[model samples]
Target: MITIVPVETKKQRAAFIDFPHDLYANDPNYVPELFLGQEDLLNPNKHPFYKHSSAQPFLAYKDGELVGRVAAIYNTNHNAFNKVNEGQFGFFDCINDQEVADKLLQTAEEWVKAKGANNIVGPINLTTNDTCGLLVEGFERPPMAMMPYNFPYYLDLISHAGFAKKVDLRAYLVNKAGANQRSVLLLDKLEARLERSGIKLRQINLKDFKSEAEKIKKVYNKAWDKNLGFVPMTDEEFYYVAKDLKMIVDPKYCIVAEKDNEVIGFALGIPNINEILINIKRGRLLPTGIFKLLFGKKNIRSIRVLMLGVLDNYRKLGIEACLYGRIIKNAMPSGILEAECSWMLDHNYLMNHAIEQINADLYKRYRLYEKAI
Candidate 1:
């Protein structure tokens, strides 16, 4: 028999966060998320996401043993912005058992249905602005920072549960040895042309991070407004994320396009911290884990070009190529050998083509699933 329990207390929440660690113990590719980070994300009071939305986590137990977990989310901001009645499920993990998976999903579906959602979509992990999608291809390696990963069987589990793919997200890998260097070579010329139009590209100023982040936030919202499932992040939400990234952000990898003192485009690349976090047992950052994080950063050899965007009006101005070129050029001296440019919507032809032009290989794919409630 199977039983599902809502995570209402501190103990249950802890168990819910820790379940994935145990389930993936034997999988060498599994990287545990930081315990405190996950704790804060699930905390209503701590995460800015909860200020405009609500979620309930459920843990599944089979014969008194923990087996799975999922979060039923009602994102008011998403619905209001997109004008759709959709609830989401996220933070999902489960054993390979079909029954357990079905029960866990059913619980989430019902909970969202009660909240008046006409359709359900996810593995969204709180929102589209956060880590999302189920790994449908490329399970050979661990995931990059801020990207999602799952067992290959998850595709079948979700399909059997009456979910179908809403869209596929792409992850491209660019190796220094294999990548074309034309972008780097032409970077100077590209910037000169952009400068003629009063747009200058430069690294983000750490000293002016607060004001810089505010400017970038506007560009981010505007640049990505037309994306599927996009909802503009509130100030609190943007700052909360910016604060966390600040610690790991390298100036060279955080490039901005400025015109008339306004930021119109930017690209952010973060060291693949998962390389270090994978070694931190259970994602605990204490006792010895903190040392691993601090010292291991220097040894990181790859970065994830996780975000790169330009305002719609600035498209096709070579700003995107310049951003990618600048990052690659700066990375060469830093001993960075490869980078992952990830989670691009498969249908985003212009962006996908831009990445491919630089010889990035489409190495991984993730899918979002949807079903009527």
Candidate 2:
């Protein structure tokens, strides 16, 4: 008999987090997530999301053998920000069995219903700000930094369980050989023109990262305010995230737009550390995994332009192109051969256009699914 078990004890929760290691043991494209990072996210006492919402991790068992896992989330912040009574399922992993998938989804559905959610949505590991979405395309290569990956059968499994597409997110690839450098070539002239209007584009000041991060947080909260399911992160949340990213953030790949010393726009490209994480056995950074992460930095050959945004008033000013251009230009000489400008809203025309104009290929697609309960 198949049964769904609530993850309660520390051992059970560790099993829940480590289940993917076993499920994808043979999949070459599967990159293990850092165990400590995953643990921190699932730990409410450590993650700030728990300050307002709650979640539960579950495991599926078939005759005593673990078969699948999922997390049912009651994101009070998401509901309040979106004005919807919906719940989310995340950190989902399972075998090819439709029955197991059904049981897992049902478990989440029931858990969320108890919390008053009328509809369900996700694959969002935590929030939209974090790694979320089901990979529906571009399976030829391993995922870029912070992106999710899954088997093709996952689509069928979720669909068979009644989930339908809510929206599609896109990933674009830019290679040094095929990238359009017109933006980079004209960056000087563009900055000159913007300077006439009191705007300047420059690299982030790592020496004053704390203050710079605070300014960028304001620009970030405002720039993406109209995006789907976006919420203004609290001060603690932003600082917490900033502290983590600071460790790997490269000033060359981090840029900002300033108007009379006020940050109005910013873009950050983090090195694709998956190159090293893939070799970290089961994502555990111990015994030797920590050495790989620390010593393998320079061997990384790609970057993920994970974030790029400009204030509403700064739109259409060619600032976006310049930001993209600068990152591309900076990467060419740094031994980084490629970068992915990703997780774009499919309908975000202006931003999508900026990417396309620079000749970024839409290489991958990830989907979010929803079903009314």
Q: Which ten residues in a row have the lowest lDDT in candidate 1?
A: 148-157
For residues 1-373, write the lDDT of model 1, one tens digit per residue.
9999999999999999999999999999999999999999999989999999999999999999999999999999989989999899999899999899999999999999999999999999999988999999899999999998788888888899999999999999999998889878988999999999999999999999999999999999999988889999999999999999999999999999999999999999999999999999999999999999999999999999999999998999989989999999999989999999987999999999999999999999999999998
Tell me the tens digit of each residue's lDDT in model 2 across 170-228.
Answer: 99999998998787798889889989999998999999998999999999999988888
lDDT of each: 0.94, 0.93
Which pairs, if any, clash in model 1? Answer: none
Which candidate has the top score in lDDT? 1
Q: How many angstroms is residue 181 displaced in model 2 relative to the true structure, after the best TM-score fit?
A: 2.0
Please provide TM-scores, in order, for all candidate models, with all chains considered together.
0.99, 0.99
Scored against the true structure, residue 173 in model 1 reaches a CA lDDT of 96
Total clashing residue pairs per candidate?
Answer: 0, 0
In order, what is each prediction's RMSD in angstroms? 0.7, 0.8
